[model samples]
Target: MKQVPPEYYQKLEELQAIDFVIVELTLYLDTHPKDQDAVQQYNQFVHHRKKLKKEFEKLFGPLTNFGYSYSDYPWNWKDAPWPWQV
Candidate 1:
């Protein structure tokens, strides 16, 4: 497997963690949509997720595929050491 920097794991873990929270909060909001505090927290986490995603993509490469993320002329999605391979 190709070697990746330590920061890659750190940032990827952070992104995964925030993403997980967003999912949980989304489920919560679905049941308790009237909770303003939960709504606010959910929005905050979404924003943070976006920022972290950008940082990760800029440093590493596209972390997702399809419409969620863009690829340059020469796609890098198939690059060595996919997230799982790391």
Candidate 2:
């Protein structure tokens, strides 16, 4: 297993936190559809998540296998070290 930079791990951590928040907010919104404040917050987080994901993809590689984050050169997604391996 190869080592990844600290910044890469930090970004993944941030993205994971964002994803957790999104899921929690989704569950809350499902039960309380009339909560405008929660809905606004959810939308804001969604936007933030997208921005972070793009930055992550640009710096590291695609988080998913079939997204638009595919690289043109050496296919970093497949070649980069997996999280568990590091």
Candidate 3:
């Protein structure tokens, strides 16, 4: 068994928090599509999400599956307990 580092969980939580904001922004855009500020914010969050995911994958293995993420072994996010379960 492998012992996961504490930072791994921290980064994962950060990613999840960003994802939640993105989702809320998505919903806002669906109704306020003409808001430029909202659009820019959404794009910024998206960029942050991409960068964070890449850093996380590099340190902790792939965070996704189906070839979307690269890893020396494989995307182990689905290997055991779900992120929420941890």
Candidate 4:
């Protein structure tokens, strides 16, 4: 199996954290969509997720082009090693 670099793992961990925040916010926002506090928190999660995803892509490869990496960047997400590969 291919080995993932320490930097990759670091970014992966951050991505996971952001994902968890997103999930939590999703549940919270379901009943509080109009709550400014929830909305701000949700926006913060999205912003952090984008940063983490960009770091992940730069260290490894893009997971999604939505805001991570540009299509012209070779789009190697499918070929990159998984987080737990080695």
Candidate 5:
């Protein structure tokens, strides 16, 4: 497996943490829809996740097989190292 920079894993860990918070907040909101504070936090996390995902994809290729992360020149997803491989 090819070596990746430490920052790559750092970003991935940050994204994962944000995703975990979002999921937990979503579940909470399902039961407490009136919690405005939680709703605001959810939105903030969502935006943050999008920004992180964009940055990650730009440097490390698509995290998923589908979506806007696809590349045209050499099909980065095919050539880039997978998470486990790193």
Candidate 6:
């Protein structure tokens, strides 16, 4: 199996963290929609997630369609042994 690039792993890790933040903020936003602090934090998490997603796509491939890539890159999401496959 090919090793994942360090940059790709780093970006993935960052993205995962951002994902959690987004989830948490989502819950917070549900009841605290008027809270400026939560809204600001949620927006910042979105920015970080977007940046990490771009970095991941650039280093590896597209994980989604939200401004990740312009060209039709190889879709490896399904052609895998899953993350733990050897």
- Of the candidates numbered 3 and 4, which has the greater TM-score value? 3
RMSD values for the candidates in order, in angstroms, are 1.3, 1.7, 2.6, 2.9, 1.5, 3.7
lDDT of 1 by residue, 1-86 (tens): 66789999999899889989999999999999999999999999999999998888878888887689766658877663567777
Regions more than 4 Å wrong, model 2: none
Judged by whole-model lDDT over C-alpha atoms, candidate 1 comes out at 0.86
Clashes of each: 0, 0, 0, 0, 0, 0
List residue ranges in candidate 1 displaced over 4 A.
none
44, model 6: CA deviation in Å?
1.1
| Candidates by TM-score, descending order | 1, 5, 2, 3, 4, 6
Candidates' lDDT values, in order?
0.86, 0.83, 0.83, 0.74, 0.86, 0.69
Error of 1 at 75 (Å): 2.1
Q: How many pairs of residues in model 2 come into backbone collision? A: 0
Candidate 2: C-alpha lDDT: 0.83
Quick one: best TM-score, which candidate? 1
Q: What TM-scores do the predictions have? A: 0.89, 0.85, 0.83, 0.75, 0.88, 0.72
Pick the winner on TM-score between candidates 2 and 5.
Answer: 5
Model 1 weakest lDDT span, ten residues long: 73-82
Give the higher-TM-score candidate: 1 or 2: 1
**Model 6 C-alpha lDDT per residue in residues 1-86, reported as the tens digit of each score:** 66665665666667778899899999989998999999999999898777767666555655755554543435555532222332
lDDT of 2 by residue, 1-86 (tens): 55679999999999889999999999999999999999999999999999998888777667766564667576566766655655
lDDT of 3 by residue, 1-86 (tens): 45688998999999999999999999999999999999999999999999999998778676777788765755356554435556
